[model samples]
Target: MTTRADGRKILVVGVGGLGRAVVEEALDRGAEVSVLVRDPDKLARSVDVRRLAAVTVGDGTDPATLDRAVAGVDVVVSGNGAHKRMAREIARAVKRNGVQKLIWPAGGTNAFADDGVTPAYKLHEGRFPGARDIYLAHQGCIDAIRQVGVNHVIWAPGRMTARGARSRDIEVKVDRSAGMYVSYEDAAWVIVEAAVTDAWDGHLVSAATQTGG
Candidate 1:
């Protein structure tokens, strides 16, 4: 498949926290943005949700709802949390729709050992017993999406602190060294970049930066 650098018809499933940020970023890039959210009112509270090209409210796990949410979109992004079952369903539906391009969020523990990811992040994973499992579930969703024939790029951000300095100029890694951490704001920036960047496809990207906040 040939790659292009145009803004896209993007449906971002999940509209809470990070998901909402992804939708806003897509809109900022001049993309036709739509979102699938569980609560219409909750989403409407966000300044941008009401202004999106389209918005659908329902459980993203249901095929019928996913069909409605995903129809006619070029890409689907599952920014929902690991515990959110709809994350898997959204991935599957995107593939079933034949829109193979997808970008999803992951945990820092999913990084490849040699991907320039920080050693501290990997150490954090190993230090906690279920850290690997927490990250593995995110990978499992990526695997399921791939099995369904979707081209996916997964993103993981290091420990995010709410410092209120939301800036996008942050560094990301596919490999890490040590002493790396990212802010939630920076993580969202990386996710938006992966969603819109021509270079991001069929890859799992992680971010740990020094400049955010």
Candidate 2:
């Protein structure tokens, strides 16, 4: 399809299910991919290490590590979970490296105001059981990225059904009518496709499946 990511250098952070998914999807799209993982062995179990053009073994939450990892890559994709500290660090590195775009998940479930920047979750702290921590972390990331003035995208996906769902038939949109449940495989594909295709550069997004879950 002659997507923008063809032969582009893309660096993906986080080595868990989502991180691995982004890596594989970027590869499937013909992007030369590199991964920054804390443990190459652990990553190897999830993805074929040889398929990666380079591997940086370190804590992605560390600025020094990320500073090196972001260098020379055309784009950066992060699926490192929603943690304030990690987000702050990654944002700093991404900003410092001058990477064109930073793509990550907002941990989902946040409804935005008409202004687009204000989230409804902030109005009430106790929206649900144990929601504060997660919402705060997601906001922390949004704040960090904004403070650093980096071009980025923060998306949210509802409940993940299959972390290993086959990587195809994925869709990214706002129609929650399809329901919130998502497959990690498809969710990962959304991030990679966005990065490679250079779409959704500075917005928050909600995800759905191609064929209703």
Scored by TM-score, the top model is 2
Clash totals in order: 9, 0
Give the clashing pairs for model 1.
115-174, 115-175, 116-175, 116-176, 117-175, 117-176, 118-176, 118-177, 119-177
Clash pairs, candidate 2, are none
Model 1 misplaced regions, further than 4 Å: 1-7, 83-85, 115-122, 161-169, 175-180
In order, candidate lDDTs are 0.69, 0.72
Give the alpha carbon lDDT tens digit for every residue of 75-117 in model 2. 8888775776777788788878878888877755453534555
Q: Candidate 1's residue-wise lDDT over 1-213, tens digit each?
A: 212324578888887667766676667667788988888888888745556888888887898999988889887877675743556677678877887477877677766566444433356655677776776776677667667666777776556664455554565665342233666666666666766665667776777656535
What is the lDDT, from 0 to 100, of the residue 97 in candidate 1? Answer: 83
Angstrom error of the Cα, residue 182, model 1: value is: 2.4
